[model samples]
Target: MSGTVALITGASSGIGEAAALSLASRGASVALVARRADRLAELADRIRGEGGVALVVEADVTSQEAAVAAVRRTVDELGRLDTLVNNAGVMLLGPVVDAPVEEWQRMVSVNVLGLLYTAHAALPHLLAAATNGRRKVADMVNVSSVAGRVARNGSGVYNATKHAVGAFSESLRQEVTGRYVRISLVEPGAVSTELADHNRPEILETIRQRFADVERLEADDVADTIAYIVTRPRHVAVNELLVRPTQQQA
Candidate 1:
């Protein structure tokens, strides 16, 4: 990873932040993308303090223009892109009936549209990297969720969004794998991230009750998975990885 450059969205907190640190420690220059400028700054400071390279790109991925600009900015500043972590997403869980339509809209915008926009913008760069960059391989890691595999009563929309991610990742992988660009999907179960905090109080209570007995995974756990996927040998592509805490049944 010494000459690699990685751009990670939702990089201000949780799994994205951890992944940035993990890759940077391994010698990749990191570009942190998120709407939170303050958090991004702090993270950049930490990376630089540790003798790692870091760039801050503040943008909301939900906007297509912003997503495209984020990708271009990374390439303009970093000179090359070797890995992309599409980690920005929203999960608002609740029963579909009588639910606020806004919740569903938010989830779709962030989870589905944002990922699409970012991936579309980064595809050409990733292809170029795989063709001519130092490693001769490029990686795209889309962070999804267990909801993608199993749909439950209260998590219908969230499930739909994650499932969309899975489908898109697989199709895109098939289209790009021949070019030496690896597209991987990572599904994590019940991680302790801000993903669950956006729900209404009632929904939050239900989530607490559901995962009470389960020791949820930390952000670093999923970040480790992202690092592993991007660092594989050029010919070896870990296409899909599902990580769950031991006590998590579904």
Candidate 2:
């Protein structure tokens, strides 16, 4: 991990923040990218205080231009890009019947379009780094969800977005694996993060009660999975990982 640069999106909090700390601790210089500038600055400070290199990139990945700029800035300033964690996403779950169309748009924008934009911008650099960097391989970890596998009544759009992520990751992985750039997917279930807060006020309690009996996973748990995928030996590509709390049956 030393001498490598990793860029993570949705890095202001939750899994993104945890992944940034985890990778930095392991010697990868981290670039924290999210719309929140203040939070990124704070995380950067914490990483630096721990003697780890950190870069704060404040941009909304929903915009293709911002995504491109973020990737370019990371390579220009950090020297090279070896890993990309596409963690920026939003979940606004509700029944498809008369649902807020805006919520569906938001999910598609962040979960699918944003991921595509960032990966497109980072691919060239990742390919270049894989050819000449210290590790001889590059990694792209796309954060997905269990919703990708199971389609519940109330989460149709969310399921669609995550399924798209899963599909895209597999195709991309096949296209790049021979070139030394590994594309992996990490799907998590019922994590205790701000993801649920994005739902409407009336839908919040239902989400909580549905998972009441289950002990949710912490952000660090998923972060550890991301770290494991990228830290594997060059020959070992952990293509996809699905993590769930012990009590989460589905």
Candidate 3:
């Protein structure tokens, strides 16, 4: 992880934020991308204060232009790209019967479209870096969810978005593995993250209650897994990792 350049989406908080810190601690130059400029700046400052490199990029990953620019900015300032962690996602949990249409749209846009935007822009650079001796190995890690694997009733739209990510990551892995570029997907189950705050209050309360009995995994749990994925040797490509709390059933 040391001396790697990592671009983390949703780096302002939660898993994204934890990934930033974990990578930085191991000597990765982190590019923090999110809509929250203030939070990004704060995190960057914290990383710098601890003698690590960090860049704060304010943008909505859902925008193609913004996604491309974020990658450009990272390469421009940091010199090269080593890893891209697509960790930005949203969860709008509710029954399919009367689920909010807007929530479904938002989920699709942020989770699916945003991942594509970031991945598309970084492909050329990752491919180029992978062939070089100096930067022989580069990684692309997409953060999906347990919902991506299992279709839970209330998490239908969320599941759809995550499933798309899994499919895309696998297909991309096949395309780039021949080029020596690594592509991986991290499917997390019931980790404590800000995703819950995005849900409706009543729904949030009900969902929270289910996990109340067990000690849920922290955002850093997923972060640690991402750090491990990108830090592996150039020849090693971890296709997918599903990190779940011991108590989680679905």
Ranking by lDDT: 2, 1, 3
Off by over 4 Å in 3: 133-135
Q: All candidates' lDDT scores?
A: 0.95, 0.96, 0.91
**Each model's TM-score?**
0.99, 0.99, 0.97
Report residue 66 deviation for candidate 2 (angstroms).
0.2
Candidate 1 TM-score to native: 0.99
lDDT of each residue in 50-85, candidate 3, tens digit only:
999999999998999999999999999988788899
* Residue pairs with backbone atoms closer than 3 Å in model 3 (clashes): none
Q: Report the CA-based lDDT of candidate 1 relative to the real structure.
A: 0.95
Which is superior by TM-score, 2 or 3?
A: 2
lDDT of 1 at 137: 97
lDDT for 8 (candidate 2): 99
Q: For model 1, name the residue pairs that clash.
A: none
